[model samples]
Target: MVAKSVTIDFEFDWGSRIKSDYAITHVTEKLLQVFKKYNSKGTFFISTETLPNSEKYIKMIKNAGHEIASHGHNHTLDYDVKSKMDLYNQIEKSKKLLEDIMGEKVIGFRTPAFKRSRYTDEVLEELGFIYDSSTTKSKMRNRYKPMQYANSKKLIYVSISTIRDRFPSGIKWMNLFGTKLTGKKPYIIYAHPFDFLSIKDILKLYDKNKIPIHVLLFYTARIGSMLNTLANCIENSQTIKNIILQKNEK
Candidate 1:
């Protein structure tokens, strides 16, 4: 089995409040094309709210054999959550929506923007999630570990790889620069749908939505073209679920 896991966060334009689906509507084929060319299967961490606009594509990803994991119902930030109930609802609602549409028990989760409270994992375990891929830095061997919560339940923590050691080396970095800068082996790489958006569209959306300069800096390089190169470099790959199963076997 390959030591790497491929993941894509199915969300809208880079954390903006825009209710757009251009990436799902326009760029998934490109992402899938790269995966197919490289004989890889990935896990998709989907934000359930995007379903109203991107359900067909979500189904397409499922039909293509990628695992469906929850990214939360609305991709809300941790600071914005009013209470633990709100956070629980965000995760539970997404899990249910994904299960209903994909016709499978959704068992994995990755918080939106990789930001979560200390209680997030506990909540995930309580919600019956088998694993979470919300962290970007992992210190253990292979960057995978069984985390025990207050309730004595264990949830596996799967990490997203970094670029040039960048803490938040998200998909856009891969889209623009490839994965040459990724971390050590057993890499768990992640990208967003918007990472595959065309440069012209990216510019238009950035201009229209006034995407912050900090977010804009990540897009200085040409986007929408490095996916094939990125995939070509990703060796035999599997969904995060399979990766975890294989690890448990070991």
Candidate 2:
């Protein structure tokens, strides 16, 4: 049987503000424990702003045998306002920062909120990035226009799958049908650290005002089950970088 290829990705978007109310470290640690239980490897897309406070966690992720990728220098969506140089620096600096910390090449990037401007691809290519997982095929939000940038084939555009209203619909589908539905195509599962957090603790901190009601509800109700289903579905899992490498070889 041919080996299955799946990309299990996590985005660390918790900054200082969310940290005030929730234990970001505890949340990530719990999720990591889940991943470890299944002997699964995942790619952690981290924002540069969170690096200062999350250095230890970042190191933990790396030491645990996972890939570390850039989630941009900051979590802000000002890619359009900045000059070309600024955009280049934002991506390059983040890549360099992660590489310096991990002592390995940081080759993948996913823009903040899956939002990117016209210059985004050019910047990524110039920065020598191997692949970008920033595009979304969802019709709901004003996400990166994947069609317009198809001409730039040098930089692989890894689209996030079946995202709806900030929830991973692809995960839901796989959980329902199992790998019989996930053919040769790579199923990129994206999630945030907060998704694994406790609902009651979140409510206690901000009276249901901190996180969006829908997100809080969805995660609170389904996170545990989702994690279990996801772990089961992940067969012969590889990082985004490794998958791209295998593709290039073929």
Candidate 3:
């Protein structure tokens, strides 16, 4: 069987980063329902800043048998990061907060937007993070094949697989258009909470007038069968942390 890892960037809604936990409060519970139906597990790279009132849900996720990883404190673009210290602050604070909530160490880290800087690897290593899933083909200029992070003794950088050998194989497109899984080798697949949000739930969060007609149509397409498709992938991929450990044991 082919090796695969399922990951979710636990964060805000569609385009805007409104200071709310609607995704966590609503979408995640729905996701958990689907995951339960499939007997699936995954790594949720949570944004610590948004995890204030959602601690119960975080604990619920942990209790439901999922790995909690760091998605940084604020879901900001790393390119705008002024210094390595800034990046370190974001990632470290996030890790600490998650560990505090779950009473477990968070060794895996994935940048909010896969926007890693030149300082990313060094900062992650310094922070003692073992598994880094922030590396994608376009962002890190890495290969589009199954491989490991080279040279690093402690940090294992598992680059996320992409579609068309370019686009990151994430939720939106995968739901609308399926991924062409070719090889029997292991690969990484990622998702976000918004991808599983229903149109009614989305309208509850966003003003219906502001959301375009086409967007609403795509939202419909994104749900239903495609949403179930995501659950199917989750069942197939299992927990990403397990795959990483299995890789290291080899």
Candidate 4:
């Protein structure tokens, strides 16, 4: 059977507005268990600002045979607003911090909210990054511009696949089935730890948060079954590094 590459990307970020009761550790543990059960691996894009506290979790992901990548210092949208040097420092510092913790070179990056400055690609190339998974082809989102950056010698921009709703959700049946039906090989799916969280956990923070009710349900309900379906649908699973490496050999 031909092995079709499927990349599962996860974003890890926390800020002041984040709920105190929502524990990343708890959410991460659940995701790890799910991936393990499916015999799948994922690339976790971690925010460097959450370091020290996230050290153990990062270690846990690494030891689990998964890949780690940079998600910037904080969940800042500064990539579009900050100065070029400031942006460089932000990317450089986060990459260094993550490398220090992982004890390995960090080669992948996904911008906060998929917002990339004009200098985003230049900075990534300068930092020796191999690939970026920040762009989305979906046209529904107004803030995100539609553009495709073909893979080159310096870096590859892996566009995030969108579902009917233009969001990458494991539970989105149409997103998975439609992609397969359309013969879109090497599918990439991006998710957040909170997607696997329980409704009870989310309700605790719902009072103060304005998160939509259906959005919460879409992620929390039948998530396990949805993930399992995804695992079985894809012929092979791979990290972004492996994908690029294979492409380079071709």
Candidate 5:
């Protein structure tokens, strides 16, 4: 049978440069819709620090048929936590907060900023996390690179790459790439609603009068194109076809 997997993690933090906004909210809801339309399931790892104290949004996510997991409480990078004790506190506390809100066992942990330290593994283990999706497989590191782990068990590392790696075009290059090329497993793709929107997503809302028209249009078109590509991948493929057929047989 074809295995399908999709995972999403939010890295919201207090000192992050971007501020949450309506555009971001809209993008997130739309993301849910797109997945639902295709009858796909995904795990969403959220930062307890950014979660609204109220349970309204959490309920909405559950009602929408998505799995909720914990990112962290303070969204502190594992390497920046200073000591093993601090790291343990951060992870354990975040898991407790998320579990209380979701009323379900949160068995996953993703490191903030994808920053790794020896403490990262220790903390995840202490918290009893069954999976970790915080490592980038690519040699190149940028703002948000995709990471993939060969093993798909407790602590599965998904590609965090934002965009496709740029390789010089070559003669033997007639191929469609991205997650499909990677494998049939539902790809773990993470992005703030802002990333899908644009670099100036928050800036435009804060100061609409000063924003340039061309820049806004560029981001809009980029997101539209990206969504289209994702839709195509979700709808068409032998792997997806197999998955659907297997479900029907069962």
Candidate 6:
């Protein structure tokens, strides 16, 4: 059977530069609550370099029965990256950090900014990763071409695929409208705490008349739009329920 899963790749680019325990702690709890509410099991793509400061949160994730995976050491974007060696270094560093935190061998990885390059395939293979969810096929020239590297082993990229792949819409459109364009496939969604935390501030910028317009129309559509895709996934995906029940049991 085709396994259906919801992988939650969590982390903020801002965290690597400035260690904010408060932000980390709050987001961690919020995630735990989300898990409990949905009774969902997710794979957290984490940065090992910052794991030391996130011990409490890491344990919360694990204890709550979630799978911990690698995001990378520095949240570095592979496409923007300078060299293959740099990619390898980040993967290796991230693996070590995750293993140390979970006290278990790590197997999965997601790119820092959903970014990828030729180096992405080589490094994930070298690092012995079982699966990767980094490819977005967005408008980002460096990232938009998944078919270019489709033959790479166990590299699972996400995009919206339907309507005969006519025009990417909904979640798939977000990345397509950006730097890369991708076909929709199972919809692997990603977000940072700041994505949600910055909502109020973002809406406040608009005038009162515009606030409702943006809030009900644009803002809601832009953020958490994945929930619909996720709901579709949850309804159709059998493994997700099992994973969640199994994790919650622990």
In order of appearance, the predictions have TM-scores of 0.84, 0.79, 0.85, 0.80, 0.68, 0.66
Q: Write the per-residue lDDT of candidate 6 for residues 1-250, one digit (tens) a residue.
A: 3334455555642433333333465456765565566776666778765667777787888888877788887764444454888778878988887787779877777776555666777778878886666654444344344433545755444442222243323232432343122344343445454334334544443332233453345444555543333344332222223433444487
lDDT by residue for model 1 (1-250), tens: 4477778888876753677777788889888887887888988889888877778888888888888888898866552243778888888888888888877799998877666565786678789998877766533323232232223248777767766665434555555545654565567877777766667787788788877777666665655455654565556778988878887898
TM-score of 5: 0.68
Q: How close is candidate 3 to the true structure, as a TM-score?
A: 0.85
lDDT of 4 by residue, 1-250 (tens): 3323344334432232363425466677866776777676767787777767778888998899888888888676656777779878988999999888878899998888677777788888889998887776765557665543333467777766555545443335433444442223356666556544555666765665756677666556554454455545443556677777777899
Comparing 5 with 6 on TM-score, the higher-scoring candidate is 5
lDDT of 5 by residue, 54-110 (tens): 245556666787777766667554444458887787778778877887778887666
- Writing each residue's lDDT as its tens digit, candidate 3 over 45-156 gives 8887776776887888889998899888888654235388898888889989998887788889887666666677788899989888876663224533233233466777
- The lDDT for every candidate, in the order shown, is 0.72, 0.65, 0.72, 0.65, 0.53, 0.55
lDDT of residue 23 for candidate 6? 41
> Which residue pairs come into collision in candidate 4?
none
Q: Output the TM-score of candidate 4.
A: 0.80
| Candidate 2 lDDT over residue span 6-116, tens digit each | 443343423333434245565767767766777767778877766677788889888887788898886665665667888788888888888889888888888776667
Clashes (N, CA, C under 3 Å) per candidate: 0, 0, 0, 0, 12, 13
Q: Point out where model 2 deviates above 4 Å.
A: 1-23, 80-82, 141-145, 148-150, 163-184, 212-215, 221-224
Error in Å for residue 102 of model 2? 0.9
Better of 1 and 2 by lDDT: 1
Best by TM-score: 3
